[model samples]
Target: MTIYGYRIPMMASLIVWCILWEIVGRLDLLLLFPPFSDVLVALGDVVNSRSFASAVSITLYSYAWGLGLAIVFGVALGFLMGTVPVADRLLNMWVNVFLSAPLSALVPVIMILFGMGAPTVIVTVFMFAVWIIALDTRAGVLHVPASLLEMARSFGASRWTTTWKIVLWAAMPEILAGIRLGVIRGVKGVVIGQLLVSIIGVGALFTTYSNNFLMEHFWALTLILFAFALTVGQLIALLEARIDYYAGARS
Candidate 1:
């Protein structure tokens, strides 16, 4: 809906929010809460600054590397587990354990083992995001139609050929969903890494601003996180839509 050349729904809500914040902030509801205008200016400055760029870049670097590793390992492990009962039984328990363990709680131990660096952060992200993907892939394998496998076998397709060409194709849709989720997890890991593991990126700046009670800077870092996460999410959604289109055409 549009009203006065602005989205009525979103614009109206924003107007109401700004008015409420201005009123409350001017009324001195809290010492910690800075005025909205201060936050917007700080956010604008942070976005254009070098510190923000470095923090964002480092975090994305770790996230990308970690996510890549997870996709490789997770898909391989999931394929094996889905195909071989023994492999499934052997690793399922440990995967469950890792999945249940909170990443925040494990950060200290990871730091102790890995010391302080990007490696620890990357490792943390991979460990947390891999299992969901692995499980999804396994489900895809399990759900592959027996008829297709049989048809391939009857046509003299070797076991390897049938497994790769037929079984793997059937599982891809589910696996894609898992990949989207894994990327989100990776983004979170990157943010956490910035905060906890040596704090070289936005997280460190967030801490500095926080210590000095610069609420604007703290909020600014949070805004960066939102933007980064949203960008990744949008990319994933676009990819998913394309995949769906291709799959639909084939079907």
Candidate 2:
């Protein structure tokens, strides 16, 4: 980023924040804000624990299932909505409502339906993620050029072939972008679900640490979750970049 006519690297900015955090922590400005060094040490301790491993495994399992289902159903529904006027009219209002709604309020309803189980968490993640993906994918489809469709038709391409090659490729960049955003939301959803419905996985650790006022451990776990989300989001962003290239090529 540029500041005072000088460009600063992102990592440099991060380091500055870390140093500031350390200073504030060491000064005891806030009891909740412990030293970064202590948090790092706690991170090492937490990572080596059996509880951490188990929690991670459960969280990952729920995340994978939720994200996978979200992508599959979201893309299919979005594709249909974009291509079919009737479907779009029928579903658009509901999609917009859900997107704008405070989904946290729905957690209790979800828990009621699915009970205190991994299924509830998976569904929560899916709920948080799917609407945005569907919306973005629909937008991608809507933006697909009419000329491309006509050209495919003129070339004797079947509807299926045109959709598969032309429509999908044209839409891929936005779809991937949506997926990246959805993944981040999905992470939040997983945590909320676990914390609210059942204290399992990383949620369990968060409960234990916060209840015991283990600030170092609490911050360490928070940092781990943040890192995991950032890493996954970065990977998805790279994929989006690659798909953007293809979209440009198609254009």
Candidate 3:
């Protein structure tokens, strides 16, 4: 970032926000916010607790399963929609609707179908993530050069070989971009699912903290989730950068 003709590090903005938060918290301007330093201390304490370990394990388990399923099905659906006009015509409207819909309202329906506990949470994450991934993948596949497909076929490449080796590879950048977005959405899904379904995992801790008015601990937990989401996004963005040549190649 630039300020007064001087470039500032990206992290400077975060530090500034933290300072402001600290000042406001110290002044008791907001009942919900505790001093940032206290939150940091709470962070250390929370991390060292056994309950935190269990919560992390449960959250990660549900998240991994849901995201894995979303990736598998989302990519497959997208590939179908991209290649087959019939499938596109049939599914595209629903995909767009789900993408724009208020998804949280659908969680209760999922809970009814999947029942309580981790299953519901897993489904929630899948529901939250899959649509965007499918949409992006379809867009990527659609953008693949027709010339590439013709060349592959002329060279006697089998259908599977053409799709797996050429089409998917060409579409890697957008697929990864979709997956990155899906990861962020999946985090929200897992949190909300746990909170609404059965209050297991980090949701349980959140319940305890909020109900007890442990603002510092609550904020610390929130920061951990924010950090996780940002870290995953950066990692995927790095992967996208590495394969950006595919986008250039497409052009």
Alpha-carbon RMSD to native, per candidate? 3.9, 1.4, 1.0
lDDT on C-alpha atoms for all candidate structures: 0.78, 0.92, 0.95
lDDT of 1 at 9: 75
For candidate 1, the clash count comes to 0
Model 2 segments beyond 4 Å from truth? Answer: 3-6, 249-251
Q: What is the lDDT of residue 56 in candidate 1?
A: 72
Q: For this target, which candidate reaches the highest TM-score against the unseen true structure?
A: 3
Q: On lDDT, who's better, 1 or 2?
A: 2
Q: Model 3 residue 130 lDDT?
A: 99
Q: How accurate is candidate 2 locally (lDDT)?
A: 0.92
What tens digits encode model 3's per-residue C-alpha lDDT throughout 1-251?
Answer: 79899999999989999999999999999999999999999999999999999999999999999999999999999999999999999999999999889889998999899898899999999999999999999999999999999999999999999999999999999899999999999999999999888699999999999999999999999999999999998999999999999999999
The digit string of per-residue lDDT tens for model 1 on 33-144 reads 6677777788888888887788777777778888999999988888998899999999988877876778777887888898788888888788778988898788778877
TM-score for each of the candidates: 0.83, 0.95, 0.98
Model 2: per-residue lDDT, tens digit, 1-251? 89999999889978988899899999999989998989999999999999999999999999999999999999998999999999999999999999889998999999999999899999999999999999999999999989899999999999999999999999998899889889899999999999988799989999999999999999999998899889999998988887676677657
For model 3, the local distance difference test gives 0.95
Q: Can you tell me which runs of candidate 3 are displaced by over 4 Å?
A: none
Error of 1 at 195 (Å): 1.7
